[model samples]
Target: MYKKILLIMLCFLAAMACSSPSNPDNTNNGDIVNGGGSGNGGGSGNTGDGGSTGDGGNTDIPWTEIAPPLPVLDEEAIKYGIDISQEDSVIKEQIRTKIQQYNKDKGGYKVIFIGTPKSEYTQQSSLAKLVIDIAEELYKYKKYKYRNRY
Candidate 1:
């Protein structure tokens, strides 16, 4: 009975092997045509005539310019209602003083302060999560001011 079962299993294995497509490398002709002559026959590999832009080709859509993030004020600046863009020297001194005060008060939780040109600021890590919050707040303030003006 064991021999009979083994023989039946062997026959089934032989039938399966024979019934399957013989050429492992050669895909079906319909698949080849549909796949752009590749084995899987999918045309996903083709990105026809798109201009190369080093990293990837320039996509079809136009790119929009994003504005730089707003800087966060230390507690004193926030308390005093100081605008960040008031004269350059005064702003610099105020920012420096604020950093020094923050360092003194926080006790070794060092905040890496930065002053950057608008373009560079947009590209830097110094304006990460905190900058996003400040930008949203500043946007609300600007909107409020605009509404009050007109």
Candidate 2:
């Protein structure tokens, strides 16, 4: 009777050990035998919700190439001389023509002419002062005022 009881207990213990859950770390080594496991035959590891994947977030579409910004022209800097002497005569003439045309088109009652001849003012320091003075004088001119009003 003692031998039979011992045998049955040994068999029960063996079955319990075999049926128990496996260690998570052992799943990596393929030692785990998961029955009815989820999804594929692979172990029960979280494989995120297989959504989109690429350069732009979780998107299926490839990243769009961005175009470079258009170059901006500095009107003031282009009008006034940065290094007047360095500018080509053709370009300078074009700028001058454009300024004149702009003024003519404006046809404002008051004109504010700024800047002096680069020739007279060898030094750039007096250029701004000369421009302001000339602008004031032009503003007071009868012809300029008359043409603008008419």
Candidate 3:
């Protein structure tokens, strides 16, 4: 068993020695001997600046991200919650805030609401569609807000 192990070790060493280049630079004295007929003989051909992966930098083109389309709160969604008819951004924000609060009180999940009291969404004829639209808006808003996050 000992002799067998020694023989295996010797064989592995021999294989490694045979695989390695005798002169990695293909050089002798101070000069390289390339097979090219040119007398300027140097084994190396010009290697580039150390093999860049190119994802991080080293380019002219600048990276830019196109902003996604803004979420549109439909007329029905605005209509269901309150009577604010102003065409102002502040009112829009207030409407969204109200919707979110109502959603939270009604056991909201992601953006959908459930188990709500009748008082909150009393307009039964338009309530379901309004809730769906509001939920969709909320979903889009959440995604946009957390765009950079995992």
Winning candidate number (lDDT): 3
lDDT of each: 0.47, 0.44, 0.47
TM-score of each: 0.24, 0.23, 0.23
Query: Best TM-score goes to which candidate?
Result: 1
Clash count, predicted structure 1: 2
Give me the runs in candidate 1 sitting further than 4 Å from their true place: 1-64, 67-87, 109-150
Q: Write the per-residue lDDT of candidate 2 for residues 45-120, one digit (tens) a residue.
A: 3222222232222333333343224432556434443343332443344344444555676654322222222343
Over the full model, what C-alpha lDDT does candidate 2 score relative to the true structure?
0.44
Model 1 TM-score, all chains together: 0.24
- Per-residue lDDT of candidate 1, residues 51-112 (tens digit): 34332343444333322356656664353332343444454454444544554776432234
Deviation from native of the Cα of residue 80 in model 3, angstroms? 13
lDDT order of candidates, top first = 3, 1, 2
List clash counts for every candidate, in order.
Answer: 2, 1, 0
- Positional deviation of 146 in candidate 3, in angstroms? 1.9
Regions more than 4 Å wrong, model 2: 1-83, 86-100, 106-125, 142-150
Instruction: State the lDDT at 14 in candidate 3.
Output: 100
